[model samples]
Target: MSPGDEHDYRGKDQGGRPDDPYSTLGGTRQTRTRLPDGDAGLPHARRPVRNSRSLVTITGVVVLLIAAIAFANRGGGSDEDAAAPGAEKPGTTGSAPTAATGTKPVQGKNGTIASGFAHDEQGAQSAAANYAVALGSAEMFMKESRHQILDTVYSPAAANKLRAPQDLAYSAEFLARLGLDSDGNAPQGSTFISRTVPVGTKVLAFDDDTAKVAVWYTGLIGMSGQDSTKPVSTTWKTWTAQLSWLGGDWKVTEASEADGPAPVPGDVAASRSDAISKAVEEYGGFTYAR
Candidate 1:
């Protein structure tokens, strides 16, 4: 087995739904609690009835009153006041600030992966997050590219230890399950999608020669085609890397993963396989920076 044959960062089955590699990490899964409503298998007691016509009249009046109040509030403020500087904006939800340090995102590239990050805390975080994306990418599924990526991102010692195991994990059986050829290429007319998007990064620890950073990210993986059984889906995870400033660059010394601070799933309808394939082909990824 070669480094290119490795399954993924998570060394688990990559068949239909790839298993969460960070499950063994110390975070526990949270479940929502359901509260029982008013009556529990009890028969309802009958009550005296009021005039149905009167009840309808009262409900209609209440609704109209609420609507009138809402309209009044909408018209309460003056246009100048609404347009004033520093005025609070309506329908604006809070979000984290942009992950920019004003430094160039990358100084150079080692093959297709970004390299030569800044030497400060922000640069270390940026390097770790981008490295996570590369390690989790579809390119890592192939032999030659995987070797290049491992060599680029990981410390020489760490890469040596991981290469053989990774190769074994991405064996022929695993590739078959993911509808890919032994070389990790998808079939003709099929698209294999694997991408990692870092939401944010936290510098857990930092120093002159070493730093630790955790990247909160979301990933998309699977195959897309007319007959694909393993349609692409999204997963949320957090990756922590212990990085060493080696060869004048931050390189991964060790890494681990954990379940995410995931957002609640939304109600967007799933797209058709063909549409998904087309979108994957049309959209290109970015050179992420912090």
Candidate 2:
């Protein structure tokens, strides 16, 4: 055996390290010869001591395997690591802003689609964010502008599906329910606001052409007026979109949303309609970048 190879031995000498200490001395000394216990020299003999060693060796191997598995399952917080076995860990990549820093929206031509994502995971997320913003904007609530926005953002197939529903969704009845006039315009002294504020978007999975992104967002709903039935309020939702890269930009093939995915409430109280209106007029949307 090599020097580094470890084997279990029984009995102890004077010094702690194994091996016979006096073997180096030239002179030979007589020592008592103990009888072999249970056929010690027989090749096929089974002994309790051998069984104990085997158990120890097996235990050591099992311990090493467990440790290795634990290390493999640990989250390194990067997108590129392979996970260890038997680890109930999340995917190698997640949707938090830290992991998505590289996925900020890029600027494309104005009057044209302006998503900055390459045809990759980041691109899919960027597309979803922008689409969510567009889908939940005041433009979608307006009859004339609604059609234009939907046509631009969704794929032809999706546009067909959304057009009928979107038309019905923004109808005179729906508009009246929000305290707006038949044309979907709010009364004087009332500010009409519909908006989606995206917190972050996570890419669940993707390929070269198609991708799925989940966007967590807060939306402002209702009309801004004291007497208005629909008072401006906030809603939390998750928007999932199937996207495809089209004409150098990402467009929605199909999309849907579910309520909540809400984060815990902060100490701050909700803002009033007046404050919300002022903020909307003051702040303008910008082209996002990764």
What are the per-residue Cα lDDT tens digits for candidate 2 across 131-202?
788778887778777777777788777887888888887788878888888887889988888888888877
* Model 1 ranges with Cα > 4 A deviation: 1-99
Candidate 1 structure quality by residue, lDDT tens digits, 6-76: 32222224233323322332322333333366543446322223344454455456546655655555533
Relative to the true structure, candidate 1 reaches a TM of: 0.66
State each model's CA lDDT, in order: 0.77, 0.69
